[model samples]
Target: MSLPADLCERTLNRILAAHPDLVEQETPLASLTSPMSPAPVGSVRVFKGSAVAKVVYVGLVVPMIQLDSHMIFAFTPEDSAVPHFTLDSVYGGAYHAFHLDLIPRADLASHLPYLDAAFHPLSPVFESAAGIEGLTPAAIGPRQRAIMSPWMLVNRASEEAFAAITEHVDAYAAHWSGLVDKGLPDDVLAGLADTDLAARDTAVRANIFSRDVDPVWAQVSRLLGDETTDAIRAELVANG
Candidate 1:
């Protein structure tokens, strides 16, 4: 599956437009720096996660960009919770956001066909190849495996963040189960369930969806098979 020629052109153009500096250098990930205040009209802050690249683009287009990081074992910043403000601070600002994971230059070449197939006008195809599901995670060609392994780890971290929340939910479920096993009265059990559910609901609505989870979900959906991904979305919706 080759990317549509036009989509390929557009994607390459966007990449070149975003990082004209790449033309002159092949710098390692460590060498990058966050732009200072009064940055470029459309500067980007790439937060490389274990498997995805979370791109925060700031400028006249959008206030900020958020996507999974592609860097291997990319460290979550200390201020990972901080909201990006570039969009709100500037007037008439909008952003185009997407995620990209590292692919070995070689694998990237072989997988280009599938990426071409996954081209979406609204979503860029830098994160993962499309139409390539059913290939075991390990069966991915070596070149792609090399590029994606780290990116997948970054993606794992994002998933782990949700897994952490799910862990708490699981614990809550277990606690409820224990109470039920102890033969608590139906009304009492119902009340306890309601209370816990209400608290989790509030936290998810006010914090998780609006802040952390939704952004990651959008990116993850693209990478995961539909059935698996939809189930995950159902959990978030139910919890939220």
Candidate 2:
């Protein structure tokens, strides 16, 4: 397996180990390789648990262009204030492009305490990974970045730099798992109503997976077709 794929599997296994209650949920569009592609190229899987509302994993391999992609999202309950977890990595022989972030449940600018409780702990790990050599900025635009946390790590890395990212991925995933288990402070929760929290989580997720916001969806559509791409987007954005 490729370095990125190896880390993705290990990180996902760690998440499952931390949350033993999580159960794999069936997906109708489990097979992502449609007639659009000549051969079997990808698959999608979903899981659900008490602490984690839903988890989606998608893996894609296009031998024609030497592309391998693995993406996962573990979203906490919509009514809870915990941030969601997401990890995406795509390796195309020469370059490794990956993005990792804890998607905030509420707007950080308005909720200082929530930000401090959830994302602040991740600052050191984010900064350390940023300093890795041979890591270049990813093509994600400013608009797309606004929806995710400031600590998001999205970059194109050299093989050496990509290998170095595994430790940071483990750190971020571990920290997120802790948040999912213990949750945010009571004071932080007091000000935010459950209804509002759910609303924001839904809206933020819709925007994050929206094709208009993220250009990568276009590329995904080309590989998976509009119907399949939309189905996957619906899964990511769905509240239930």
| Candidate 2 C-alpha lDDT tens digits along 168-222 | 8999999999998887778888756543887787788889998889887998888
Where does the lowest 10-residue lDDT sum fall in candidate 2? 190-199
Instruction: Please give the CA lDDT of all the candidate structures.
Output: 0.26, 0.86
Candidate 2 positional error at 10, Å: 1.0
Instruction: For model 1, give the 10-residue run with minimal summed lDDT.
Output: 82-91
What is the alpha-carbon RMSD of candidate 2 to the true structure?
Answer: 1.5
Best candidate per lDDT, number?
A: 2
lDDT of 1 at 199: 37
